[model samples]
Target: MKIDVHGHLSAPESLYAYKANLLAHRGAHGRGSAGVTDDTLRAALTEPNRTFGNQSHLRHLDEAGVDIQLISPRPYQMMHSEQAKLVEWFAEETNDAIARTCRIEPGRFRGIAGMPQSMETTPERWTKELRRCVTDLGFVGAMLNPDPYEGAAQPPALSDRFWYPVWEAVCELDVPVLIHSAGCRPPARESYSLHFIQEETLAVAAMLSSSVLDDFPTLKIIVSHGGGAIPYQRGRFQPGALRAGITFEERMRKLYYDTCLYTRDSIELLLRAVGTDRCLFGTEKPGTGSTRDPRTGRWVDDIHLLIEDIDWLDDGQRKQLFETNARELFRI
Candidate 1:
């Protein structure tokens, strides 16, 4: 039952241009070549040499020795369309695409639907999409970025009351909210390059400090990129919170984190901080060595090292980290 909980899928071929255009636009503005435009993604789509296009990503997962991979559209795309009229449609299409992939091999894959945060600006919109993602699409959960709005400089949407609507919905769905890193506001921007993990670190801090977890006691959250430095800085957050007359260590204890860092030391530190029960396996894939199977454009291989590296873990801890914990959190 070894499982890698964090995995990503490319935009279906029809959506490549939309992504490429975004990257080209950002590149023009000095955002760096990190952004890949639709053309580039499309070329990957059409390239005969490449295997991870759209259809065969799962085969790669098998090669990686992963028994299960939780798949989702890019987290950034959770906010793909800002226009109110397009939010529902965007959510529908995204979930539909995810559902299609999951159907290919029901037990081996699970989908995490992307819900637009902006649409959640209103309570009703949040309710609708959350229901669709959970009930209609059969997705296990939703993926959220650290920031509420894409390209904005602020903490997580958790600080805003508008997001409460979605928070409530998540609790009702009994699904884990997967929070990944994104951009940050000023002062924080400087760390973006040096500590690329900062965005998600700050977001987890905000969630613990804010009253979200307190408000929804049953809500579960999984942080990406090895909990983005939070486990390493757990003590730092509590002392500061106490000094400010706000203590949240107890609530912070409820959070679940992933092991996406590539090194053994990094994984050991997080395991020590959070303990094996609160940790899960993740590879960030594609960015690592996850390419696609030749015929199917889907992910062929995923974050497999997490399991191979488990000889250092206690037998019980290893089982919880790779399989049991994720099953309890995701109900898969």
Candidate 2:
């Protein structure tokens, strides 16, 4: 019953071709279909490639002892900074691809939709697609891009009223959201790797400092990459939180974190900071940390192995980390 919550789908090549055409035409061509077929999808997943992100991913999961993986669109390819129409269409295509993958193996996969978070659109507008993904496509949750403008333009912080519509909808739908960031467009800005951590860290800070959790106490947000440095640097904000008359650590406990941290020490620190109850097993297999570790002779993304080796985690805590917490969070 091991479940990994932070996996991304490798989209079919036809989807990318459609994207290239859409970008090339700049909306003059009007929106076209994502011509991905069953055969092309088979080719995409079954064939060998540089990363096993999608290529034979099921086998990789089996070898790593994962029973299920929640699949979402690759955050970097979400195209959130494009025009509203283009972003909407591409998001549909990307979500459809993820839906198809889950349909191919319902027992082994669940879907987290790619939202159309284009800059000009409000969070309310994104809920249309969010609802469609949940009710119509049978998705369990969605991946939210914190910076849809790709650092070109700063959007409203997650704590602002601008995001209330989406939070309201999330309460109505009962689906959790993953706080992930998309590509970096500015030449001088950090790469998506660094940008991911920066945005996630900011999201944690903003939400904890504000009354978002108090306003929407039922909202479930799982920040990726081990909650983006909060577990390590929480002391920096403790003084400010004390002045404000709230426990900073208590606010942090309200949010969830995924075990995508690569090293044993980092994961241990996350558990200590956020608690085992707040952590879910997640391996971004075939993504970052795919390379074999020079020290351990195992794929760095084999997080279950790392968890199994943690001597301090009691059996119940290990059970919670490897299986129980995800089932409870995803309601799967």
Candidate 3:
């Protein structure tokens, strides 16, 4: 069974309506409901107008040769820089909607929660939502935004003691934390897509340089979008300017990577850098990769085909990349 580790919910318009109301009232609405129902979900997913979605999320999964997908809230739209209460309310509702969607199709989908992170709040404070999603909502894992304040200000690095609360909790809970960044609001920031790359590159560099993993040995992290230019530009981190204490590649292997890179060449580089055992299939389908690659007729998010095209990969590597790695990390 091929399990895609990276996916975002194709939520109903009604669920997003809650965001509109919350923003309109500036959280004075007292945490509005998503108003999501199965029928609304069906219409939103299967309908022709998805903003960036296909006719159906399930159909995209099938077309991409994915059996199951672990889905989280759309990271770009999460609005992590909003006020704590407003962010938390929206996050709670999004997780609830994801749970609701997974329940509708237990075999095809699983929930990966989005934490309500805001500027100036302790990371541990949001652990309650992480715990709720895992224990109460029966989620498999969660997406941790290392920079919740976006690009407005410098937040604590992932290796800092400031994040100890979250690290300690994930270690005990035994769930993998996806190292992804939320929206970027810096006046001179690059496009949102490029922002994901910048944050992930910084996260990998910082985590490797510090002893975060040594402090919590059991903690698992999956760096999305193929480690965000780190693997490709390995020479920049070759133990000269930045010291990871250990060899850069060895430290990199300690963390996991996802196959969300848009090109086959980049995915190959990541697999070579981190090895297949430390890699998992992650398409991020219906996100930026929803569009078709002109050279190939299939959508860019059809990562299974991309991996299949890599001639050097053996069957064992293919098996690990497509299924084994995700199964072990998620414990499914």
Better of 1 and 2 by TM-score: 2
User: Over the stretch 175-234, how does candidate 1's per-residue lDDT look in tens digits?
Assistant: 888877433334344543233366677767777767777788888888887777777777
RMSD to the true structure for each prediction, in A, is 7.4, 1.6, 1.7
Q: Which candidate is the best by lDDT?
A: 2
Would you list the C-alpha lDDT of every candidate in the order shown? Answer: 0.64, 0.87, 0.85
Q: Which ten residues in a row have the lowest lDDT in candidate 2?
A: 49-58
TM-score for candidate 2: 0.96
Native-structure RMSD, model 2: 1.6
Pairs with backbone N, CA or C atoms under 3 Å apart (clashes), candidate 3: none
Cα lDDT of model 3 by residue, 253-276, tens digit: 989999998888888889888899
Candidates, ranked, TM-score = 2, 3, 1
Candidate 1 error regions (>4 Å): 18-56, 78-82, 86-88, 119-123, 153-160, 182-196, 241-251, 288-303
**Residue pairs with backbone overlap in model 2:** none
Note the clash tally of each candidate: 16, 0, 0
**Residue-by-residue lDDT tens digits, candidate 2, 1-332:** 79999998866788988988888898898888998776676666566656754336666688788888998988888789888999999999888888888877788889998889986788889999999999999999989888988888778898898889888987899999989988888673588899999999999988887889899989999999999989899999888878888767877998999999888999999998879999999998768777777777888888999888899999999989988988988899
So what's the TM-score on candidate 1? 0.75
